[model samples]
Target chain A: MLFRLTREDWKVILYNLGRMLHLLSFVFLLPLVPALFYRELDTLSYFFFTSGFTLLLATLLSHLCRTDEQMELKHALCLVALAWLAASLLASLPLWLGGACSSPLDACFESLSGFTGTGLTLTVDPDHLARSLHFHRHLLQFLGDGVGIVAVSLAVLGRTEVSSLLAFRGEAREEGIRPSVVRTTRLIFGIALTFFVVGALMFTLAGIYEGADPGTAFFDGICHSFTGYATGGFSPHSQNLMYYHGLIYEVVAMVLAVVGALNFNLHYALLTGRRREVFRDTEVRVFFFTALLLGALTILLLLGKGIYTSTEALFRRGIFQLLSAQTTTGFSTVPPLHLSLVWPLSLLFLLSLAMLLGGCANSTSGGIKSLRVGILLKSLALELKRPFLPRSVVVGERFHHLKDSPLTPPVVRGAALVATSYLLLFAAGTLITMAYGYTAEQSMFETSSALSNVGLSCGLTHPSMPAGLKLTYMVLMWMGRLEVLTVLVLLIALALSFQRRKAE
Target chain B: MKRTLLCLLLCLSLLPCAGATPVSVEDLVRGPQEWDGRTVTVTGEVVGRLERGGHVWLNLLDNGWPLGIWCTKEQAEGIRVVGDYFHIGDRVEATGVFRARCPEHGGEPDLHAENLRVVLEGRRVPRPVNLLLLALSLLLLGAALSAALTLRFRRKEPFLGYSPESF
Candidate 1:
């Protein structure tokens, strides 16, 4: 009750935050290459200014907070929370300056969406955006989702061993593959690189097979691979995957999304020759079963009303949409208007469930995560078994993830708390959207898509959308990306800080 | 006989011409079934092109949203300007069979063009550099570089007693 975070506590937080800014200064400069390539060099000054400004700020903050002190768990938590907001704010500068966004808030929304790997966009007419700016949008996803910003900053630049690892945990990427966080980050980066190389190559071939020139194919291939493996759905074309109009390209995207969403621990097991974890893991089973249920319902709905005539159409439009949502990847073969206007309500609701029950935990995908969902369901089953047991009998169960892990009370409760928080936030976002005169179904669909960090939209997201809704979805994307608790901690810290300020 | 001929002419006038009654791509996307397999006219700026064996795929941008059009190579050859970062694309009107699900190409929603005509020639999009914006950019950039350079060379002089390990 007496807890008060003094300014002294923020010294370490701001210091590490500056370390993150050091990496971000380079991020701002990334778009300049594409600008040069596309001959949009007139806009190059914006990137230079943003990069230089960030570098100066980072230098200043580091000097101000310079001390021979280490961060504790609380400091790490606050740093992770503060870093995302700060990075998004700094990241929006180039986007706004490039004239891609309609307003500052819209650019901020796009920046957060890209930074969180939430593909929702308010960038006005992305189809006409400058080439370098378009590349920056995709690059944001690669840094945030593929190589986690927190993990990379801490692993590469963080000086303190204990606190750096704590920051990794606070970022929800603590499933380490090695003893040291640096080694783990390196291994993860290696895995991501291997996948990116292979995926890009395959996508390029697919694009060529579908009748594209080498230049466009190679360009789209590299960019798609970045967002695809990140499970961060962003595309240069406004039409998303429908721009390709190729079945093969859609297939490649689906495979990449699934690969991105797989549990990293399982990937480690398979690399170490423990191949059985693919089928034996409880989290993996939950993901498949849920996918199967949702996919079947969606496909059945498509076929029931004669949405398409042939198998190819069914696969590209129907199956692709379901898998995209299940992976929490926002790539769509259908237009937003089509999804909102023509798709059956039941199918939209099914897609909502798919988005809400996203891929496995500790993966790039976001939702209540498969492992948590599995634990909650198992706990429910254990309770169901209670009525038949003797009064004194205490039943305990275990589920296999990377190994056999007990369904402990704390684990179940944590899962429940997170799930409850997600649903409540979903409700709040839906209510705000409804208050703006959208239908209940439309509100629910868009809210879940944003809160689950699945970038799919049902015609509710656009540049002309209410700014209030834009702020709401931005906050939702941030909270959902961090799995709520980190943001909640930041909020409580802010409140306590203000209370302390008033008391003084 | 005169009345019958006049009535036929009236009916003919009721139907839309090749360039008339241009259907909205958004409308077709929202209600594909209603327009599926129907002959329709569409007008948009040609933005991108992809060559097939004998045909070419042109992405016609209607107010910044793209609608794919499958046209013969001859039709695509007439397109002199394709839009990108630098220039406005050729504005063209095409009469085609709008497919809700094109079976030939992965069931993608597209139009198979029967006729094409360029209505407007595209030119270089005006990109006037605002002097005010350029000035602000230079000033901010200058300030940033100066700050970075000053801190790098003289931070130790200000805090000479500070330990290097602290950072």
Candidate 2:
């Protein structure tokens, strides 16, 4: 029921729109770097020209409107939903115009992947493509992911409303470092930049030490750094992670991926010298524990399938895939489809779970998030424990590091909403994929990958994947990136608006 | 027994010369397009290669089909390119363009130059990060939208806290 929001809610939405417009303009500008480098004047001009016009429009619109108000949860969700659709449409301009992506559907998929941090690609020969195009792909992932709510919360117009902030925390961010939203956003950016810059340097060194071409290696370092920190996992190479065959490189990537998946609040805490807080945070603990357990299971499965006879190979490949998928990074050192069918299937399930859990709140990673998953699990456990407790007991349930957490009702509702949307998207993806004559398992895996914004595939993605399936994946990635609630609100709002029009 | 031993000795004697030529990949490429459907010999620097289904797909500079030479995984062992070089400039020959698609599909010979390669295997000058930064910055600056955000509430109140009439 979003019938009437406080006047302040309008202000919040408008402010966010202004921010989104700015974000979109910056995103469009990302492709130009590679375009200029590859000396593809056509692509370069395309990016520059579109970006200029788009920016001019956004600036004009932003200047024409002004408001100072708080945003409720519903309004915030609506803002997120509209922003996703609008940004995706705008992001497709370069691809749609550039001859590189011929079909509108393919362009949408590329844009969706770029925004959602899903690294899947429909391009046949990424290496042969102009350097600008190649860098544009990664640049999209870099910018779209680098700025999380926490990073930019501080940057948005000042003095957020308390009630709105509380509601926003439940849905939008896992942690707010201060009572003020702007401060939180600033802290987020600071931590993200540190990780990004440092991560890039490390990857570059690792690449050089392993005898990689300095130029390619440097570019790869930047792409991987952004992708890893964002947990987006879009690789520049078509072979994904398989192009590189170095032990240290995989290790470096894994570390960065994990760091990306971790909670930004934890980073803030660590940066502030809260060492004990890092250990005590329940989400961080569950995320790593789940990763380790899954990593072990995956290694065993790979070993059983004879994908790797040696323990060392099994450990290396298994750990990398686990981190990649668990973080929803989607990077892989092996051709995942080439793995034993059973193993890939299992890995897919684990990855799906990870994607569903997502990374920590207020970070670049998409999906439901580990913190929410942890809360859901705790809530479920409490329900089970209720019967054993005395009638007088208050239960006093608490999970660590979460302030103002939801009780059973809200948490259950949130989880169900997320689950329902995810399943629907996955189902839609499968149905469309089946039309392309993809096998059931392949369809399921590919859809799950797209919907989760986890780009692992079972040989189904290609330029030839039916336009319908491609579009479906685009919708899934868009929804996955924003989480389902925002999209659902948008859908419901549209439906209601149409009904009202009919009634009149 | 004597006849069998003599036959084995004759077959063994030819093995050394066979080893010397090493079944050149170049031989596979120049043989014939008619033989394209079958395995032939070709060798060049391994470049712009992608491996799938136990076959390694690569391009030779001289071929025009752009149809990749497909070699079994076993056949591709020990082959390596020194730099970021792939199909564009590597000098090794290839023998596997026999699988080239019919020209009707715009499929010419499987040999196509890759962006990474150059003649004599030299690399094109790489773009510096400053250049990259400038390009990316320019793109970002151009694409940004500065629209004022708008919030339109749903027409019907689905919960107790909100009401359509209140709007």
Instruction: Return the top candidate by DockQ.
Output: 1
Per-residue error at A70 for model 2, in Å? Answer: 6.8
What fraction of the true Cα-Cα contacts (under 8 Å, chains A to B) does candidate 1 also have?
0.49
TM-score of 2: 0.74
lDDT of 1 by residue, A361-433 (tens): 8788988899889999999999999999999998998998777899999989998999999999989988999
Model 1 ranges off by over 4 Å = A391-394, B1-20, B126-146, B149-167
Looking at model 1, the pairs that clash are: none
lDDT of 2 by residue, A116-204 (tens): 77888776545445556666666667656665431243244323555335434433564577766666666666777898899889888
Quality of candidate 1's docking, in CAPRI categories?
acceptable
Predicted complexes: DockQ each: 0.38, 0.08
Give me the displacement of residue A57 in model 1, in angstroms: 1.9
What's the number of clashes in each of the models? 0, 50
In angstroms, what RMSD does candidate 1 have relative to the true structure? Answer: 4.1
Give candidate 1's error at residue A115 in angstroms: 0.6
lDDT of 1 at A446: 92
- Angstrom error at residue A207, model 2: 1.0
Error of 1 at B156 (Å): 5.9
> In CAPRI terms, where does candidate 2 land?
incorrect
